[model samples]
Target: MKTFFSLLQKKLFAENAPLVMLVGLCPLLIASKTLISGLVMAAAISSVLIFSCVVISLVRKLIPDNVRLVAYMIIIATLVSVAEIMIRAYLPTHYVNLGIYIPIIASAGIVFAQADNVASKNGIVVSVIDGTLTAITFSIVIITVSFLRELLGSGTILSHRMIEEEYGMSFALSGGGGLVILGMLAAVVKKINSIKKSKKEGE
Candidate 1:
């Protein structure tokens, strides 16, 4: 249990998916205009990633070594399709907002890469943990950007209207999306460098 928690923390924070691995940037950038949207997309994508990884891991042995990539893609697509259906039935609003991006999760290179590189070779328990960690990492980065951008650009958080109604900017489609992503990327990189320097000093 201690080792599991340690691995989880490292994957979720020290080696975050979006900030460190830099995966799932498309929906991350697009849905970050509002904290609500970013959170919704993150949840959806994370669920898909976890499910896909589990399914792929289960079938890994059956897949021929040479055709493993194709097998993984098919499994990912199937899981993403199921995710879309479940989300549409239960979270209609999020389903609509996420739109085409939800399906794009199937095509996300991160999904296939994780399956092919880590999950396939690992046991079920480890694969599931890795998937959950990767998903959390992806969510943290995108949601952090969304939080900052929504607060700074529109003075709102999670669409709760933190700033005065008259004072806040409109939640238009393209508002601060690119700028927020760039700023977050820069900030994350700087933070990583600072951490490395601190580690070296400690050493």
Candidate 2:
């Protein structure tokens, strides 16, 4: 139990999927123009990842080792399809806004990484936890980026007008701008980790 909790903590913070591993940047860069869109994308990705992980873990033993990658892809595609249906039914606007990115989640490296490295090897409970934590990590990073971009690029937060004048930079709303911001964020995280490591060594 202690080990499980430790792993969860690491997944959430220390080994954060978006910031650390840098996976799933396609949706992160594109759908993160607004907080609402970013949240919706994150939710969709999370749902698919969690369900796919659970299903894959359950059937891991039955799948042949050689064909596991193909099997994982199929499982992820099915889950992504379900997620697409749910999103379309409940959030039509987001469904249209997200567009092709929703289906792209099926091939996202973050999802496949967890499916291959964690779900394929771990028990169902652990796999679920891993998926959930990974999703949360992805959400945190993307939402944070979206908040910054929307506030800076559009002078608004979640579509709410914050500034009286056009104080926001338009470039921040673009994909290239997102990559720059993400890179800066990664650098900051790396610096913070280094500081923590040094402090621990000094202690």
Candidate 3:
């Protein structure tokens, strides 16, 4: 329990997949145009990442180094397909809203990188823990981004009308705006990390 909490903190801050590592940015930006859409994307990605990591870890020994990347891609692609189908069959509303973006998880660099760096080298338990923490941290970041975007761009949150539509700035909801926000977020996190590093060094 202590270890899980510690790792969760690390993934959430020190090694955030989106804000820090910059993985899964495409979906993070597009699907996160709305809070609910971000939720859909985050859930789908969490499922795929967790499942792929476990499978890869379980069969790590059988995979050859020469073809490891190819094998990892196949595993991730297959898991993403499963997640997509599940989302489509049950969450038709989100499926309509998020359409093609859910399938993009298979191509996300973070998933493959985790599979190679953590899963392929670690046991199933460790891989599952890592995947779960990564997913949780990722979900938090995307939801935060989307909520801010929705509030700023649409002047509403989940259509709750935080402000009048007339008052809203369309730019906040656009791709360029998302990039600017993401870049800003990345810079803030980097600054915080640098300060912490300096403080530790000084100590």
Candidate 4:
């Protein structure tokens, strides 16, 4: 139980999917142009990841070792299809905004990596917890990036237009700008972790 909690903590913070592992960045950089778009993508990915992990874990033993990769892809694709349909039906605008990125989740490395590394070898409960925590970590990073990008680039939060004039930098809204910001944020996180590690060593 202690080990399980420790692993959960690491997934949530120390080894965050987006910030640390840097998985799922393609959709993150594109769909993160706006706060709402980012949230939609995050939610879609989270739902797919959680459900897929649960299903995969439940059937891990039945799957053959040689065909496991192919099997994982099929399972992920099926779940992605379900998520895409639901999104299209309920959130047409977001569905369109997300575009190809929604379908791309079917092949996302983050989902597959989790399935291969943790879910396949773990109990159903552990797999579910890992999936949920990893999704939450990814969502947090993407949402934070989206919030900053939208605020700095569009001078608005959730399209409310906070600033009187378009004072925000235009470049900040671009895809290239998103990469720069993400890199800087990652560096900051790394620095903070280093500092904590050093302090612990001193103590």
Best by lDDT: 4
TM-score, every prediction: 0.83, 0.94, 0.95, 0.93
Residue-level lDDT of model 2, residues 18-52, one tens digit each, is 88887888888888999999999889888988998
Model 3: lDDT to the true structure: 0.88
- Each candidate's root-mean-square deviation in Å? 2.8, 1.7, 1.3, 1.9
Name the TM-score of candidate 1.
0.83
What does candidate 4's lDDT look like per residue over 39-109, in tens digits?
99899989988998899999999999999999999999999999999999999998887788889998888
Query: Candidate 3: minimum summed lDDT over ten consecutive residues — where?
Result: 4-13
Ranked candidates (TM-score, high to low)? 3, 2, 4, 1
Name the regions of candidate 2 deviating beyond 4 angstroms.
1-9
Which pairs in model 1 have colliding backbones? none
Query: What tens digits encode model 3's per-residue C-alpha lDDT throughout 1-203?
Result: 89779778778778988888878888899898989898888888888889988899999999889999999999999998898899989999988888788888888887887898899999999899999998898898889889989999999888899898798889989999999888888888888788878998999
Task: Compose the digit string of candidate 1's lDDT tens values, residues 68-135.
Answer: 77878888888888888988998899778878988888877678768877889998888888888888
